[model samples]
Target chain A: MSAEMVHTVSPDGPFTSISLAIESAKNGDIIEVNSGTYNEHVIVDKTLNLVGINQPKIDGGGKGTVVLIKAPDVTFKGFHVSGSGESLSVEDTGIVLDSAQGSIIEDNSLDDVLFGIYLKKSSGTIIRNNNIVGKDLPIAVRGDGIRLWYSSDTKILNNTITRARDLVMWWSGDTLVKGNKIEKGRYGLHYMYSNNNVFEDNLFSENYVGGFLMYSNNIKFQNNIFARNQGPATGYGIGFKDLDDIVAKENLFVDNRIGLYMDNSPHSVDSWNTLEDNVIAFNDIGISFMPSIERNIIVSNSFVDNAEQVEVRGGGTLAGNNWFTNGRGNYWSDYVGYDENNDGIGEIPYKSESLFESLIDSYPNLRVFVFSPVAQAIELASDAFPVIKPEPKVTDNYPLMNYKIPQRYEAEEKGFSYKLFVVSLLMVLIPSISYVFIKRKI
Target chain B: MDTKNILLIMKKEAGESLKNRWFVLYTICFSALALLVLLFSTMGGDIAGYSGFGRTAASLINLVLLFIPLIAIITGGVSISNERENGTLPYLLSHPISKNEIFVGKFLGLLITIWFSILLGFGLAGVGVAIIGQQGDISGYLLTVLLSALLAACFLSIGFLVSVYSGKASKAIGISVFLWLFFIILGDLGIMGTTVAMDLGIKQVFALALLNPTEVFKVASVLVLSPRFEILGPVGVYAIRTFGQQGVFYLLFSILIFWTLIPLGYGYLVFTRLRREEK
Candidate 1:
């Protein structure tokens, strides 16, 4: 057997380019490339290690994929990759692992690329600690930061992605996405036909949607923060469609148009989903469910200060979904029920029954009067006259009496603004002093 | 128009309005309510969890919408009818002041009275919020105050129209109360009925909402709080899109200005013609 060798690629070395070094190396050889701009596309078809000594630059010259790894057990890291082609149809990428398995891609910075990393038919891959910025095009025209197609058992960790269309996974299963911060994109994480996936501690903000999981089943999401994904049409912190057997726990959904939007989740009649111990707060609508959504256990969550807490689209009640489990229910900010006998559960059930809100669910145009005195009057009148009270959209018999804010949102408390203080004081003093002066003069 | 006569009547009306019992009571009630809204908005931070200027401003806007127009209409509706019923209008007309001066002077005086009370209410509440060290949006609060004062002026103009049309104070009060109920309930019914009956689009709903001054006030206040129109649902989004952010403010202001001018102008023409007929 031949001994594995280390080949050097430098301006002054035997091989001046990375492709030349790869050509000169064996199947399991190491190619160490020094810090220099290589303005050519390179393809590695053998098992090799490509290590950038001082973070070398791979400039694609706005052409095709900068680096294509077609072999398994390839290690590519410590490089700045840029200048990929702009054609979305051709799927230009900074790094492409085609049918490659067990590859490690880490510590790379990719910018001005259509797709930052494309994993096609690759499994058991680890993509870690990369900063990916997509091309400066229209959001529709922009490509994804990391795209996994037909790839399974991949781990994506701690990568910062921005200004891309989406970090998408298609037909990928058993993927672990953790500690990633995604902002200013279309969909932060777009999942489709993926199963047995786990997402934890991801921060998705300022995108059209934080994460949308569609189809496939048995996914778990925990401690993920979805915030400020306020698109006009699809501003959802997280959404589920045709999904089954999902568990989302201890997640924070805040400041989105709709905190959690569900449509036909737990699709099979025997399947069920669980959403527990989440904080859904300050959104326009919290936990908007489609009419046919059923068989979901939603308990021990905090629904705080949402404009509308439990809205059933298409004008039907959420009686199919269970709001309480084992005498435990979610904490609702607008819950008017009392807890007698020193129990944590409220004696009177928490019922979401606002006549105006129900009308709005049926007729969306009535939302024009939201936050107006007319809406308040309708609610007050309904409270005064129970005969006019509409049926409850949701009922939690053992509603929890207390909620603790998650630490992630608790850390964002802003300090006092002295400017506001001074202005308010002025607002008070100027009017009072002027009123007195005007009266005395009169 | 005699400038000296107008100024003299304005001062006399202002002095009288300042001494009125209802005016004083509304001032106190509005301030107390504003303070309570501010306090509750901040205190609910532990429960509902969001406390800041935005929440306070929204609650204050509702409080202003419910009370400001009622106070303005009641006070302004009876301004002329009370004088006419007590024979003071004839007495004042007997003076050198022309009818034009008296009309403009009364409107300006009553507007100032409304402005004073609104200022005091928002101001005291602002001070309480500030001293408590709660975070708030000062500019938004100020804009709400400005919008509230404009709303008061618009209702005052409508009230003046009612004052001139009605002969007795009791009739004026009845008309004012009825108009108040109509405007408040109009927003609810207009949206509910049109949407339920016809399923009108957002553009049509916004057009209908613009017809009512109360709706305009509510929309403008929401815009101030959330410029992105996130909380207002589709109507706010439509408004922001049709008129740009700055354009919505201008549009609302012009609508309110139109509301104020048309009624006041018609009221002036009718009041002057009626006085001539009486003479």
Candidate 2:
């Protein structure tokens, strides 16, 4: 057994470049690159530790992948990686861990990158504290911030990504994504056929769609804030499709077009997921369910001031789902039920039905008249006559009298916009005062 | 058209309405509704869990489409028919004025009055919202005011057509209400039903949408004001990409102007060419 060698590469050193050092290096060797621009691309094909001192630059000169790790146990840290090719078809990447297992990629700043930190068929990888910003091109051409394909047991943590398409995961299991701040993209965190994952304490804002999980199971999403992700076709805080055994708890979804859209979640079987203690506020629709969606344990969430709190999109029913669990139900902004016993539960079962909404469900085109007098008139009439109203899609037997989520969000800050209130008051006040004065003078 | 006689008839119509306190009442009515719409919009957004000028403007759409047009058409609908019914049209025509001049004068007069009321309504509402709300969705707010004004003008022109076509004031009023129902209320539903029953896609639906001015108004407003048009799915993106956002807007405005000018032109032609029984 031979001892691992240490090589220091510099512009004027024994080894002038990374490729030169890599060619001479053996297995389990450490290559230190000291603070100079490397204009050439390199591929690590063996077990090695690559450390950059004072943040060395790896510029691809606007062409191929900046750094390619083809070996297992390759650890890269503290490099400014950029200048990848703009060809989406070629999958140009800044740093690609291709079939590299147990690799550590940390503290890399990727700028003007096509794809930042791409892990393909890599397992047991750690991607942490990297700042990734894609090109400011249109979303179609711009690349993903962090993409994991067929990678398992990967931990992506504390990465701040902006202006990228998505931090995407596909067919990856036992992956943990935590403490990331993502904004100004299409989808903040997109998952497809990835199960047994944990996502926590991340912030997603101003994206087209915040985060979505599809065709996977046994995922846990907790304590994340999904805010201000709005667009025409897919502006949802968090959307789930055909999933099972998921727990989405203590998340705050605010100011999106649709907060949580469940499309056939629980996956054609008796529901097993738990959606609890989340606060969904200021969305167009708090929860939009596809007609085939059914049977999830939904409880203790606060649904505040959404336009349509619950919309059954293709009109079958949400009747298969459980609106309340353990004698405790969600809190609705429109619920007028009282808690005489002071147990934080409503006295009567809360019915979520209005005639106008039913009309819209039957005829999607009637949505143009959403806030019309006709809709309002029908709602009023339905409220006045319960017999006229059909069965509600969601009925909470013990609706909570107050919001159950302990966390506060940015949406709550809009509640007391005192500056606006004062200005409006002055506007109305001056006119009335002048009118009164003129009358007095007359 | 004789400019001098047109001015004379315009002054006569304007003076008559002013004497009846019609402008004052209409302005006040519009202002009240404007404020009500503002309040309603904000409150509705709060309930839906989102608040912005776009949401507010989007919510007030129904009021602007339904009520603004109703007011405009009603005011314009009786302008000519009432004169004929009161035995004043003969006297006005006897004063060496052409029928085109009379028709154009009455239209310009009523349109100006309605325009003033519309301006006042939007002015009050916009000023109120601008001062009180966050400036995030201000463009959408202003666009709503602009579109609603165009809607009012469109209906006003339709009202003129109905007025000149009918023999009596009562008949004109009846036809105006029916026109309102057909365009504003029934037009949307009929299109939706037909699209569903016939299994029509976006192209057909869009073609049908062009058939009604009200549908044009709704689509234009939704495209501009609401960010939730993504609910239409990929077809929406395809539509925007195909039309180009500005192109659809230009087309809508052109159609609005077309809807305004076509009936008004035909009505003027008929009013001039058709012989009056009394005269």
Candidate 3:
């Protein structure tokens, strides 16, 4: 297919068009590019395919990587790469893949880049369906939208990262991160000392600190969602610092901010993690177990609403099949509780833990008046005068109510279509201009 | 002006506060709070016997009412603006003393180096609670370190009246660190915005948080460490039963003797109005 090996970049080609089609390509050459705006910075080094055709964009003329593959079976399809380098300690990229290998970075879009698809020391990569969009703050060129350093067998699929400060997979290993969506990030799926990973159906919303797992281990999270990660002060939705043999199941965690913050981790296996069939409406604390956490397993979860749900500081072992909607049998929209055998499971079991979470597990800034309503009326008068509930383990006898209720996910109806098209165009032009002034004053 | 020239001007102002480096950084932050209460009481009885001694005397009375008014407003805002920015107060006002013996020898050498750094940080926090607390109570850590060193000598006499009306020494250490963060974080965020605009009434939120001196030093250090927690409702039990106990010890000893006599009588009337405007 020699038209000079199908080169063709825009405005009548050759102003170093895609670096002269990677200096006149060969190993399965294809270039293409065409639709306009190509400020510069190409660098592919061989085993070609570069094809952009209609979405062609490249930019970074503001000096910083826009595309720097280095070589191996490369394939950056449908490009859009934007400006790079904001310096979170430099390593700018829009589509870097240094020390490349069998690459196939698909459907690209990256905007203000520090990194959109970086993969240094690259491996058998497949960073699919990219759409990254960063910039919220601390960006002295800090990036990472689909990063994979010290790479391995990768597959990060269905990407759509937003405001990324980190969507990484460092010290990478066998990765397979599935169905990603990740929003406003500070960390939505950060993987440190990595190993056998496999996060499935990822969503991880409004991040400031969601999905972080340091000192990584044999990972395997399933059916992920993890909503509204409120932040700026050690925020967390699914954090597992100093991690180990991890294995979370049927994950959901709604209204997060310590919805699953386990520190100094140990042999973990939090089974059937179906947390309160989540839509966790408002959070301050739902699940937090610190103090060098140990041999874990908190089965079939659900601890509704959260203003103090389940905080078991230092020392773990809360047996199988969990559920506590907060009233008598979990459903605390501030539970009043009394369901005389209508059997929706409210014959009394709701303790919902608090005494300022046992005085912040023996004082950790007694959580600055733990959201004082006079400290929630002294933790609801010490839950009607009972000194301790620190050891009441009940794991759901019959819990379930509404398992996965969030089905409005096209980015939340595309963020409510401009407020539902300005409230349906003012409800049909204010009732059709008041019936056309009462039929033109008939 | 006599008692042997005010004891030879308080022994040369205690030999320039024992060669001060802010009294050796307040004796190494009171020996690092007595080595963190002797490593949280020798980590025995599993960490201070899991919060005993009235929650470790209410967390050391909130770290001594938040760092003894920040070490008495940074040692009374650099005592007289670093002796008039190192001119050394005009050679200690041209000796032969007597401006009441150089204001009682620089207020007894800054009140004996701030009461000997609060009794060596409460005798090394009572030898770290008698070497790691849990023998029930060391009388609530000796009445919260003697009422937090008498409320850090009434905030070092209101930071020696803002370092004698601040005329540099970096404006008396930036107006005593913004008047100790405006009485500790905008006086508890203006008493939590007047207890959410007076709705959460506990006698108008304890009469507007007892006109905030950090809520009267946290309700007099939780009424001297839990005199059985009815914890001040009814306007903190009517402002401590209408200021009893000899009228709250004569209103905190007349606000610490009017911050040690109105900044040494207005710095001896501004050094006799600058020596009658230099004659």
Every candidate's DockQ is 0.48, 0.11, 0.01
| TM-score (C-alpha) between model 2 and the true structure | 0.83
RMSD in Å for all candidates: 2.6, 5.2, 23.3
Q: Model 3: residues >4 Å from true position, as ranges?
A: A1-29, A32-48, A51-57, A60-74, A77-80, A83-103, A106-125, A128-154, A157-442, B1-34, B37-61, B66-112, B115-211, B214-279
Q: Which is superior by TM-score, 1 or 2?
A: 1
State the lDDT at B261 in candidate 2.
93
Give the winner by DockQ: 1 or 3.
1
Candidate 3: clashing residue pairs, number: 15
Scanning candidate 1 chain B in windows of ten residues, the lowest lDDT window is B44-53
| Most accurate candidate by DockQ | 1
Residue A36 error for model 3, in Å? 16
What lDDT score is found at residue A75 in candidate 2? 87
Of candidate 3 chain A, the 10-residue stretch with the lowest lDDT total is A409-418
**Model 1, residue pairs in steric clash:** B53-B136
Better TM-score candidate (2, 3): 2
